[model samples]
Target: MRYNRNEAFRFAFKEPLHARFSIYEVNGKEVETTEGEIQLMDLSPSGAKTYTELNIPYTANNSVKITIHFQLNESTYNFKGKIVWKKVWSDGFMYGVSFLVNEDMQQEIVKQLKIHVKSLKN
Candidate 1:
């Protein structure tokens, strides 16, 4: 499928997530870190678009550790993500992150999102 670069998608709910990205570059020899709160806008199989206070300048394939929080089954869930995409915004940087090494957590997220989407449909 082809996508237009200037398309708008609305989010069902703005989930709050906070994470610290340990950015590595220069062949794993240089590192920098930034902490910020992200407002997850929308999610797709490709990635998620999030708004953050820290504007991290990164290229494609840059690795980052994102610590995020979500609510599932009436409990808060926290997990880390690997940065996949980064873009600059007026407020800050928007990043696309892929969840790392947590199948259960990912399941819980999917469950919550499914429940939310289902409610919207009804």
Candidate 2:
């Protein structure tokens, strides 16, 4: 089986990479909930495409704004993001989140991605 999507992250590391994440806020409101693991199928400095068991109902053309927390390269990161898109799959929900990060955070994300990639070669 093969994926035909011309996604950059898919070709970069050539392996499945996952990040444990929690949606800390929804629609600008703080949420008290359990954490859920999400597969970061596509990642970049500005955003990530993730697959997870978590689902935030979307209706009336409202956008889902959330604070996402995750760990990468032994460092924890928190990003405010908007669920730009979503789709329901067989066993999970796929979400495209656009991160609202500063320039420094974007650079940090890129750095971690590079570090992770280098680890794969070892």
Candidate 3:
């Protein structure tokens, strides 16, 4: 859960979400649109850890759109992530998701994360 850039925001949600990237999900799983799901772990803004799988659609520097649902209080926010990095591991593939653009929901998450960071700094 480390980022190369400290400017990236991190927020936790109350629940796990079903995310669909601009790529595609095969058989209700996350993967390259044409391929199958590759095991993933160690998620963060900068990168993640994944197991070895063939046809790893995403590359080290490929740009991707990651969509995940986020909820806080009574509001639910949909997130679109831009890929930063992807790495290969003996176990699987690790990936990174970056926020794409500004939306009201994203702004709220950013605001909250900023406050959280500020609190930590204090």
lDDT of 1 by residue, 19-117 (tens): 334444433455555544567666433245677777665576545555566543355655555677877888687787665645565555566666666
Q: Against the true structure, candidate 1 has what lDDT?
A: 0.56
Q: What does candidate 1 score on TM?
A: 0.59
Runs with alpha carbons beyond 4 Å of true place in candidate 1: 1-35, 44-47, 118-122
Which candidate number would show the highest lDDT if scored against the true structure? 2
The models' CA-based lDDT, in order, is 0.56, 0.69, 0.46
For candidate 2, write residues 65-115 as lDDT tens digits: 666777777888877787888889768888888888888987888788878
* lDDT preference between candidates 2 and 3, better one: 2
**Candidate 2 Cα misplacement greater than 4 A, ranges:** 1-33
> After TM-score superposition, what is the CA distance of residue 8 in candidate 3 from its true location, in Å?
6.9
Q: How many residue pairs clash in each candidate?
A: 0, 0, 10
Off by over 4 Å in 3: 1-5, 8-56, 103-105, 111-122
Of 1 and 3, the candidate ahead on lDDT is: 1
